[model samples]
Target: MGSTYRLQLRNQAKPTDPKHQPYRFESVLKVLNNGDEKLKSWKVFVGFRNDEYLVSASNAVLADGTSLPANVGNGTVFAGYPMTDLKTAIETAGDLNQIQVQVKLLGTQFGVKPPNVPLPETIQLANDVHLS
Candidate 1:
């Protein structure tokens, strides 16, 4: 069976509270299965980047038969970056709008063993929001 999968970013937003510490932001990672094959497990590398440097990075995983829906799963809010670093990068680039989020599927399992499914390349998440 021909099966395909893709990663997307959702619920991207910046912190509105002034009391919030050091330029914090939040977003969700969405794993989508478009094909008919039932996935048993999968892993992906996710990160945020600007024109100059990577702001943050993390890994996500899904297991069991919980991979059937179009919205297969959701990843936790990746608070892996320091606000100072992100601010520095933004200042260096001189454009907050240049930052982008991306994800890459590392591997997948159809059953108890590895499948012939080809790993998809890294893709940029659409509708990325800029932090003020």
Candidate 2:
């Protein structure tokens, strides 16, 4: 199935001395399928260019499905947890509810300050022809 990837980063809290410590930020990774068929065991690769640490995440697991904490700075692949398949927007009777995977992530990034956005280097569906 054809799909598009979106990454949104936001730092709403104002903390003191962020440069000295990890700057807290929120990130959402979304993949919207616009193809005719649903993708089973889909995987999305998130690339990071900075030293970022992921504190927590939801509705996602490491591509290998083992690591307790998903790392960002080092770059990692995220796979849907439990809900392994990404159904088409129309497959769910146009509800569009299942389309949302709720890939909200909380993390701390070091070495980035004001005027700079903590965005991933690249976001894409890394799964090719192979299902594994």
Residue clash pairs of candidate 1: none
Question: Taking the tens digit of each residue's C-alpha lDDT, what string does model 1 give over 1-132?
Answer: 111234232221243333421222223343333223322233323322211111333333222222322221122122212221122223335333222222333221111111222122332222113111
Candidate 2 lDDT at 26 equals 74
For each candidate, the alpha-carbon lDDT, in order, equals 0.25, 0.69
- Which ranges in model 1 have alpha carbons more than 4 Å from their true place? 1-22, 50-132
RMSD of 2: 3.6
TM-score to true structure, per model: 0.24, 0.77
Taking the tens digit of each residue's C-alpha lDDT, what string does model 2 give over 59-92?
8888765565545687888888867777877778
User: What stretches of model 2 exceed 4 Å from their correct place?
Assistant: 1-21, 130-132
**lDDT score, candidate 1:** 0.25
